[model samples]
Each structure stands twice: as structure tokens, then as C-alpha cells.
Target: MQQLALFIRKEFIHVLRDRRTLLILFGMPVMQILIFGFALSNEVKNARLVVVDHGRDLATAALIARLDASRYFEVEQVALSPPALEATFRRGEVKVAVVFPARFYEQWQHGRDVAVQVIADASDPNTATTLTQYVSAIVYDHATEQREAQALPYGLRVETRMLYNPQLEGAPNYVPGVMALVLMLVCVMMTAVSIVREKETGTLEVLLVSPFRPVLVIVAKAVPYLILSLVNVGTILVLSTTVLHVPVQGNVLLLLAESILFITTCLALGIFISVQTSSQQVAMLISLMGMLLPTILFSGFMFPIENMPVPLQVIAHAVPAKWYYIIVKAIMIKGLGIAAVWKETLVLAGMTAGWLFISVKRFNIRLA
Candidate 1:
């Protein structure tokens, strides 16, 4: 009991001595909550929109005015032709384009139905779907108000078309983000601490004296955990598919391969962290502070990148999890193959290589 108490005291001393680790452990959670709460909300506002009022009547103008007055939308451009509308959407400046059909007001006057066409960018299915709903609600509200005041029989209908995720099930969106967060947490944190433990307990030097090559030593340490992570990957797959109802619409083998790649990338980052920090506390701090928060914020898990401040949006590109989330969504939701995800896969490969090259170089320098 005395020995155990002494060991606990020693651990406290060690933890207290490391200021960086202490700060990260205490500060990271607070920072993450604040960042995610304020900056990462899914609710969108001031979304860039285009309007084509073909009817040019009072009712159409009033509808447009109502939409423009709302804080959720921003009228960026007005297009008169279909080709021009397509060009505006393709340029990526506008998220949704609203078109009022000809005789929009006359139909309302004659007790006929009015149709408004809403075209949304399918690339970001969540925002696109949400915007389409917003357009409908606003139009409906405007018509209801007019009907109540004027006692008219006019009906207004909204036609919605979503480009990418036609069905806005949120699971597909979260599955990829979950993959990123889990891999980063499990791979980097565990591997980093294990490696540092060997060094702290003087087992690493003993391993160096043994017959095994240092690279082999590193491999032997990583291999078992890599296999374990595969089991975790399988569990996540089952959970996501059977329990969560987010099924893999793409090749199962391809999805497995991508998971392996992402796991390897995370392991490489762990190895890099292992090389940088001598203590388990520092390694844990790096994993939590450097990996976790960014994974949630930048991966577009909670916040739409379009709605974030420009600086934060730029910083998101630096997060590898951001790319992996996109890959996961493409494979799981869109069912896209390598042809579609090659760019993201390439980016992951590059990031993995960078981490490996740096870790190996640092390890070799230490040996020399």
C-alpha cells in the first residue's frame, strides 16, 4: 500500500512538471466546446441565392422581397435565362436558384395554381436540401399571408430538387466524421502512449540491444495494435450499417481498403507524435489537443464549411480528417468508387507518407 501510494505521488509529480500536457488536458475540452458551439452549427444563414422572376408581377416581387428580407438568404445575382442560371449555379457562387414561372401573378388572380422552381447545388446535399425547404416555407408563408388578408383562393406550390444527397438522412454525414474521430483518437493516442511507455520504462534501449532491427522493433510494436484497430473498424462497420442504418452502398472491399488506409495514416501520425514527445502525458496532450478538436470542427461534422468564417474555412483544409470524411461520405452514401475519391485518397496517402518520412528521419537521427 505504501509502495502504491508512492507510485501515485510520483505520477502526480511527473504530470505537474509537464506544463504543456497539463494545459492541453485542462484547456482542450473548453476550447472544443466553445469552437463547436459557436462556429459549428448546422443552421445556415445568408446563403448565397439567385432569383429569376419571369412573371415580374406584384405577387412575385412580394415573394422575392420576403425572401430577401429574411436573414437566411442573400440575393447574389438575378438571372433571366436558363443558361445564365445554370452558369451562375455552376460557378459555385449561388447555392440555390429560384425561378418564378411566366404569368405567375395572372395564374394567382384567376384562381389557378402557381409553380416556383427551386434548383439547388447537390454537391453539398445538406445545405442544398435545407435551403430548398427554406424557400418553400417562405413562399408558403407569403401566400398564406396574402390569402388571409385579401381573402383570395390562389394557391402557391414549391417544387424542390436536391443535387447530391437527394434523401437527407444525417447518418451518412456522421458516419464518415465518426470514422475520422475514432481513427484519430484510437490510433494516435494509444500508439503514442505505448511507444512513450517503452522509452520511460527503459525497455526501448533493451530492445535496441537485442537481435531485432530497430525498424522491426517499431513494426512489432505497431502490428498488434494495427490488427486490433481492424477489429475496431469492423465493429464500427457493423454498428454503422446494422445498428445505425448507414450502409455501404459502394464496394465493401473498397470501403475496407479505405478504412485501412485511413487507419494507417492515423498510425503514422501517432508514430510521429511518439517521436516528438518523450513522455506519455505530452503524447496524450498532442493527440487530444492537436487531433480531436480539429477532427470535429474541420471535418464538416457539425458545421457547414460554407457558413464558417473565411479564416476557419481555410484552416479546415489543413485537417486530414476533413478529406477522409469526404471520402467516407462518397463511398458510403454516394457509393462512388476510386474514380471519384482518388483525389482524397491521394491526399491521405501524401499525408501518411509525410508523417512516415518525418518519423523515420527523426528516429534515425536519434540513433546516430
Candidate 2:
């Protein structure tokens, strides 16, 4: 116990003594959270809109007012003709173009289906879809109000209630993903680099020759990292809730427990990577390629896994972050209990067990 305590203390001192590494260990999460929360977002805002109004009637004016009032759009340009509208779109001056044909008000007065042409830049399919939906909702609401004022019979009403995220805010979706990414990168890379650095400097040989068993040495090295990772988890959660306004609707203790489990899994994988490499560069490369890429890409952190190709979807199942992300979204967004996310929890547990077993086996073989 005394030897273990001494080794853990030494590891902590080694980590704290390095100023750059210490900065990366603590600063990276804060920076990523701020960047993702403030800078990067899927929700459309201030998208430039061009209006081509030939009617110049009350109905056209009402439509223009609605578009301007929408937070998603900024009606900055009014094209006189289709050629000018095309020129605006070609020049990338506007994302959407609305054209109100002549007799738009007359058609509405006659209770006919009024045609309002909406053209959006489909270069980005997601953004285009959102813009179209926002415009369509506004038009539908205005049409309904007009009909009701004239005692016109109601048409089909489609009521959309967005569950979990009523405002469709991006922070709730991104915060949990950022948490998974930060924890995975920090735990895996730091552990792999620390172990490989020791091996490169010949100090690992001295530790191997000491009375401490090989497993005990590995565990002692990981102890400080595990504690530090928990601190990171707390920091991320506090920032996510307070600054980002992302709420954790589930049991906070459960979320922390799951985060610890994920940290352990990443640490074991890092040990495995360290055992496979002799140099710090190789360890860092493998950690980045093996953990970071898959965590960001295949884990459904930024993109929907269901939209991925079938082969890639199958590959994503092997990523630990994939399961962890799902578990987090379920818990934090949906307020689901353990019973709802039991399958993901079981998969993570299995992965941790498998990684630890393989890492222990490789460590023993290397010692031999």
C-alpha cells in the first residue's frame, strides 16, 4: 500500500511538473466547450434572404414581414426580376429566394391556392431543409389566419412538437458529445504518452525491476489520471449546465458513474497502446488515429450514425465512444433511467472488460 501510494504520488508530480501538458490536460476541454457552444452550430441564424415580389400587394407585404421577423432569416435584398434573383444566388449573396407572382393577393381573395415560390441553396442539404421548413411554417400560419378571418373551412393542420429539445437548440446535442470526446482524448492520449515516455527514458526498466508488480505499477500510473478525468467531467458538466444552458435531466450521479466507466475503458486502451509501442511518437500517433478519429467521426458526435453507409454503421458499433454518446444523449437529453439505457450500459461494460483483459494479457506478455 505504501509503495502504491508513493508511485501514485510520483505520477501526479510528474504530470503537474510539466506546464505544457498540464495546460493541455485542463485547458483543452474549456476551449472546446466554448468553441462548440458559441462558434459552431447547426441552427441557422441570420441567413440572407432575397425577395422577388411582382405582386407588390398586401399579401406579398405580409409574407415579407413574416420572413423578416423570423430569426433564421435576414431579408436584405429585393430582386426586381428572376435574372437578378439568379445573380444573387450565383454570387452567394443569399441562401434563400422568395418570389411572389403577380395576382398573389387576387388568388388569395378568391380562395385559390396561392403560389409562393421558395428557392433555397441546396448546397448544404441540412441547412436548406431547415430554412424551407421555417419559411413554410410562417406561410402556413399566415394562410390559416387569413382563412379564419374570412370564415374559410380549415385544411389539414400539422402540429409539430419537438420532444426533448423544444427550441431545437444545438447546445444540448453538442455538450454531451463534447464531454465524450474530451474525456476519451485526454485519458487515452495522456496515459499512452506517459507510459511510452517512461519506456523511452529507461525509467520503465527500473520500475519493472522494482518490488512492485507490473500490474501494480500500471494501476498506480493510471490512478492520478482517473482522478484528473473525474475533475474534468465535473468541470465540463458545470460549464455545460451553467454557461451553455444544457441541462442534465437525468440522475447526475448516474452520469458521473458512466463517465468514470468510460474513463477506465479509455485508460485500459491507452495501456494497450503503450504496450504495443516503444516510442512516444508512435504512442501519440496510435492514440490519435485509433481513439480521436473514431470518437469524433463514428461516434455520432457531429453526424447522425443512421445516415452513415451500412458498412460504416457496422464499424461504428465497435467504437466505445459510439455507445457512450448514445448513453449520454439518452440520459442527459431524454432523462432516461438505467432501464432505458441498459443495453448501451451493458455494451460499455463488456467493452471495458474486454479492453482490460486484452491490455493485462499484453502487459504480462511484454513483461515475460
**Evaluated with TM-score, which candidate comes out highest?**
2
Model 2 residue runs over 4 Å out of place are 77-79, 364-368
Q: For residue 68, what is the lDDT in candidate 1?
A: 93
Runs of candidate 1 exceeding 4 Å displacement: 1-157, 163-167, 309-311, 364-368
Error of 1 at 159 (Å): 2.1
Per-residue lDDT for 2-91 in model 2, tens only? 999999999999999999888878999999988898788878999888888888899999889988998888986464677777777788
Candidate 2: 10-residue stretch with minimal lDDT: 359-368
Please give the lDDT score for candidate 1.
0.76
Candidate 1 root-mean-square deviation in Å: 11.8
**Cα lDDT of all candidates, in order?**
0.76, 0.87
TM-score of each: 0.60, 0.95
Write model 1 residue lDDT over 1-368, tens digit each, in one string. 45344533544465457675445333433343334334554667899878888888888888888899988899753646888778877888789989998899888877676789999999999889899988988888887777778787544545566655565445566666766777777778867886788788887787667655656555555655566567666766776677557678888898889888888888889989998888999999998799989988888886788899999999998788898888888888778899999999998999989998888777743332
Which residue pairs collide in model 1, if any?
122-163, 122-164
